[model samples]
Target: MEPRPLSFYLLAAFFVLFVLFLYGPTLTIGILSFQGPEGGLTFPMRGVSLHWFRDLFQEQAVGDIWGAFRRSLVLGLMVMVTTVVVSVMAGLAFRKRFAGSAVLFYLAITSLVIPSILVSLGVGLIFDQLGLPVHWAGAGFGAQLTWTLPFGLLIMFAVFNRFDKSFEEAARDQGATAWQTIRHVVLPIIAPSLIGVALFGFTLSYDEFARTLLTSGSHNTLPLEIFGMTTNVTTPVIYALGTLTTLFSLLIIGVFLAGVAIMGRMRARAGSDAGKGV
Candidate 1:
């Protein structure tokens, strides 16, 4: 075993502090989410109670919490499924050096760098000019895709870059059609990365605010509903909403991570047989 170095200890300390800094306030809010009905936002507990949690269901307590939550989940799931398919196809396309590939790559990059609010506003204006209605699942879906697709493409780029070409070649030699090669060979190997992209897609779409602002129009997603609560309501319910959203995000990410880990262990157990060319 190697002796510990001072730099190593310093880095370890920094990482621990960083984790604390990142999650400290969120944990506090989760605790305060249980603040008694009589309690205000900050500080000492009036009494520990699930009053706000129960109130979360009451129609008058918060405007359309369930409706907004359902919309966000639907949108997130939509983004996840479409993003995996599109990104995986795009990743396969980018595997070859073709004309204007650089141009397309740069375009995706540009979409990511542009301010999301601008995209939302531009999309809203375009709909206005076209005399089309702006709807959460319509224009808002397109807008969130602009944000998520770039990220998905970037992730796929990394995944495919490291992927071995021999798998596809072997599948082809086995008389597999292009679709078969992708489905049976490329997909299985890249499934973990795709799960990772799905996580990114769902989380980004669910939490999105700026890109969804104008385009969501008549409907509100959970995040937007919370924004309304910020001004229109004052109570521990806000903390409860925050706690709920944070937990939901954590649950989603955890499931994807577990999927990845389980897939990895399966690959490991399969050993040389799994990696061998068919």
Candidate 2:
């Protein structure tokens, strides 16, 4: 290929740096997973082994860790459902301009911008006084809903933003009720976005630590369990878990990307059909 332009070189460099920033820790952990216990902190070729993977399965803490993972998954699914239901309603209500709509919308997005630790502390205190239902593992799901709902709303808003208003108008003009219009016209178009939002919520729910740490009463989620592990005999088993987590994270991202790609192809196909009809 011919010499690239300066802008191309700059963009390429930026891309590389961004990839490094994102994947550096994951790469380090993957490498560590192969490190022998005796070769702690040693770099470059400690003789790769599957000992850590085996140890991870054999660890005494594995049962508790798996329990935490199950709890996290359950919480994440609940959060996803709750977020979708709440966001859909909020999004529909928000479709129209009304007094305080702007205020509500701004506040919904504001939660995401706020630091999680501060919110965690505040929620913890509130739970303390309110005597909320809580255990170490399950204590924080309710608290997490407060954050997840807002995040879901923001995602829903983005999904709804690109909606074709005329479809709703046409449905209404055809004597369709508001509910009918939403059901027939608005919702189908936004289904992909809904899926995207659910995945996003799941990802956030899975990785949530700061808020969970403070709010969790008795149940420890996987992230909390991992944090606890770090304080004690840190092992390559942790690294194995890290690798598995990294794979899971990649899988989630891949699924999301595939969803977006499929949506893009669908949109393209729809556009092509429209052009043909025209």
TM-scores vs. true structure, each candidate? 0.94, 0.86
The 0-to-1 C-alpha lDDT of every candidate, in the order given, reads: 0.92, 0.79
Query: Tens digits of per-residue lDDT for model 2 on 92-115?
Result: 888789899989878867776778
C-alpha RMSD for every candidate: 2.2, 2.9
Candidate 1 segments whose C-alpha is farther than 4 A from its true place:
269-278
lDDT assessment of candidate 2: 0.79
Give residue 97's lDDT in candidate 1 (0 to 100). 79
How many clashing residue pairs appear in each of the predictions shown? Answer: 0, 8
lDDT of 1 at 25: 98
Clash pairs, model 1 backbone: none
State the number of backbone clashes in model 2: 8
